[model samples]
Target: PEDSSRAASVVICMNTDRIRGAPMAEAEPTRTPQVDSRAILEMDRLHVSVDGATIVQDVSFSLRPGERLALVGESGSGKTVTALSIMRLFDAAGMETRGEIRFEGKNVLTMGMPAIRALRGARVGMIFQEPMTALNPLKTIGAQIAEVLVRHEGLGGEALRRRVRELLEQVRLPEPLRVMRAMPHQLSGGQRQRAMIAMAIACNPTLLIADEPTTALDAGLRKTIMDLLVDLQQRLGMSLLLITHDLPVVRRYADRVLVMREGRIVESGRTDEIFARPGDGYTRTLLEARQVDSMVDAVDESAEERLSCRDLGVTVGKRRWIGRDTLTEIIRGIDLSLHAGQTVGVVGESGSGKTTLALALLRLMDGARGEIRLDGMRVDGLPEKRFRRYRRDLQVVFQDPFGALSPRMNIAQIVGEGLDVHEPGLSRGETRERIRAALTEVGLDPSVMSRYPHEFSGGQRQRIAIARALILKPKVLILDEPTSALDAAVQLQVLRLLRDLQQSHGLTYLLITHDLAVVRALAHRVLVMLDGEVIESGSTGTLLEQPTHDYTRQLIDSALMT
Candidate 1:
């Protein structure tokens, strides 16, 4: 009976592996070809489906050793899905993968569970797009990287710790030992991303798959990460599979490009060839979107100030057990003025206090010391209850549409919540009319009002967020990284929409973003922020073309490179 029970357990395990489409035995040893083959990875007629819905269809590609390949597409375009499929990282029960994913002559689809596990970190490493979500918050950086080394390389004790420090150093992280002890949240965005890269390459994988690796980073940091990737790839003699929507990145780094759209590869060719002479209309459109048109016209300096701030400063404190609260000032005393019918861009890298200034101007943050005037009315010193009257005229669109919009609420409820609070006297019919108008203005269909935020795409969700802000008919609208999360094409569309809206309604904008391209597209006047101070301020044309400050020059140069 005991023997039968053991046999039954073995059979169940085998069945589970088969259900996952994983091989029951270890992968066979590679058989050397007659001639030296250059292909390190190949995908032939690959298709992936999740819960009966196709996410990737008939994708085929190959990566030669030490070559860089870019997979370009918009959101929900199967770029990430295809990459994940190659890694076999999907849920086995819900995901169905077909066709071949050959890695060094071994078919990953038919590799045994142990073989796949062995290949993942040691031979094929993946750096996910968002480091914050990918890194385990509970673990220190050392522990995270150590686990990879211990599992794949069998390094332990002092040897494991030394390897962790070396990995951190390889990624160019400062104070490797201190960084090893620090938590993910304690590190900056760029630092966290470097840590992620360190973990991905802990075992010195032969192939690295970086998905939107520089998406959340600043322009300077973006260039740094890109350089690091190229450096590491060349140093390790590894092939790179880069999945991103940044066209400039594709041009600069990728040797070849595959343009995917709606789960299918629309075009594939050499990076230079495709860019120089795109075969598909969609590819051409994407390229055209990269050429930003100046959405801002001549600024009327004589116009009245719609929003003005003087000596604005914001500070916060961290409580400690043994001493007084540790105070940290985010924004220093800074003055800002936005003229009516104008867009004033406040650009900076991460932690440069652009968002802090916006929050202070909106009176959303506590411990803000400043004098704020909106249309010549003193609103900063007013109490919360008294400030209610000015709320309708002052609104904001946040950075992350996914985070900004309430998941539980439908589109109508989310957009109409501001109206319910600010204009309670309006009837239900009037509220519906206003919501419809707002949705239409943002280029979203009013029929989607009953749908939840998750049902919509990233671009659509952003439009919904814009509608929520615009429904209030605010004179001064604060846009904080409004189009940063969107793809290049969607970003251009949103910029165009904002321009049209501003022209029609004479809306004053306080645009806060790290994207200089966005500033060039929509902002009339630009203010470059560094360490909470306005380092440079001028018209977008002059500031971007011939930046006077050293820091401003660096920012512009980095942006142009990307």
Candidate 2:
């Protein structure tokens, strides 16, 4: 998995011309289309309901030919359901829809199943948020790309293969031959997403619906993918419909924006006007840029380090059944210092060894040839039995809370599991009280301690994970991609909570993420890693503004800043 993420960083950066494409604000067209007086896609007074619950009520919008319209909203705002209604995907899911969805002056809701199937890939194409799940796992990349071609264009054999490779080249993916032969699991996240885009645009659909297309990519790759979409839209002369929670992206690409909240469109206007002067309170709140106080000045340099590592190196190797196995160096000559009541941001694209460095510092691996010190004491070379006591002093919060927290375990058991091992002598009443305190500290309802992880939203589950880590009262926390999966509104909330907790408890944090905005808000110091080494390190304000390395500069420039 680490290798995959790393490969993404390496491949995308290796040939900027191939993946990044030309830096054109506008696309040049190859051909002109006859003007259509009617809107390309229009939804009037649309209503979407699942069972007896109304999710979307009276939503309306329209897209002109070759125009880009962005539907902006947080999670559970019915943005996705509205988009799905256009293609009549709700029918397969047993969801009810009402009102008119007119594409080319024909109602999509009144179409038969056979007609809808023909309309899907042939006339309307959609790029899902998560490509790994949307794509067929058992099929090769070529087969998935060719499926849409064969069904929609009626091509077969060499013609289909040729078209597939051309589409792959059109999306700017490197090495068409290698990519075609690879399975979904073999390719990286960016690669899978590019392949998905190729499949969607195979037939040159009239409308391209990109639902959070770059959600899983790092800042550089996000820019690349978005630019690629724009390039394709201009070349094909098709309208673009983008659905996302990323406000920066909306500002950068969308000609117009529709702000949605709780299944209703509260505001709609020109992109620049809406951003400059938002009429809706909710829109203003969504666009508000949070300012976080850095702890660098508050922290005393003379004080002992909370966590520090020196010459840390991690070599990954496989055990051989017959002879000596091969080994590869993952992390090399890594060194950093973290002080109490401060946050250090480790930033790089996927597969840059940021996670691997965190793993080494967490001491989650063995054969690490380096010195790891916690609270001015050595811990790396200690034996398992002797080092067991130090486990409570170090804790980590993972990226995906849904995956990190067990589905079968309730909130109380999940949070108090650490205490069961460290403080086994405590009474049940004390344990329950501690659990409640931990939950309350992270802004969760203490009464929900009996509920399971599945009962909460993405933001709520992340808070639960934070509670689980806080219950141990660790001096340092290693957060790996903590807010990348959350909505913009929810991400700010979590960052604020982390900041408040750090101020009150004097906790140290190692924030590992690809989000430059998050780094700006919370991190006092920043480390830019590439290919298993720290390329640059300095104060956050200084490093970000005056980056010395070209890679660091590229990272900052690629970020979708507000």
For all candidates in order, the CA lDDT equals 0.79, 0.78
lDDT of 1 by residue, 1-562 (tens): 1121111111110001111111222222121122424688999999988688888899998888888889997877888778876767654458888899999999999988777766664577777765665677788988877776665557788977877787677666777987898887656556777788777655556788888787656787776667766765665466889998888878877878999998899999988899999999999988888888787888689998999989999887667889788677878878989999999999888768887788888898878998999999999989999998898899999876766788899999999999999899999999999999999999988999899986666789889999999998999999988887678988888999999999999999999888888898999999999988998999889998989999999888878877
The best candidate in terms of lDDT: 1
Measured by TM-score, how close is model 1 to the native structure?
0.80
Which residue pairs clash within candidate 1?
A: none
Which residue runs does candidate 2 get wrong by more than 4 Å?
Answer: 1-35, 49-54, 88-97, 103-121, 130-205, 290-297, 315-329, 363-369, 376-390, 401-435, 447-457, 560-562
lDDT of 2 by residue, 464-554 (tens): 9999999989999999878876778888889889988988888889999988888888898899999889999998999998999999998
Instruction: Please report how far candidate 1 places residue 86 from its true position, in Å.
Output: 2.1
lDDT (Cα, 0-100) at 447 in candidate 1: 94
As a whole number from 0 to 100, the lDDT of residue 483 in candidate 1 is 82
lDDT of 2: 0.78
Best candidate according to TM-score: 1
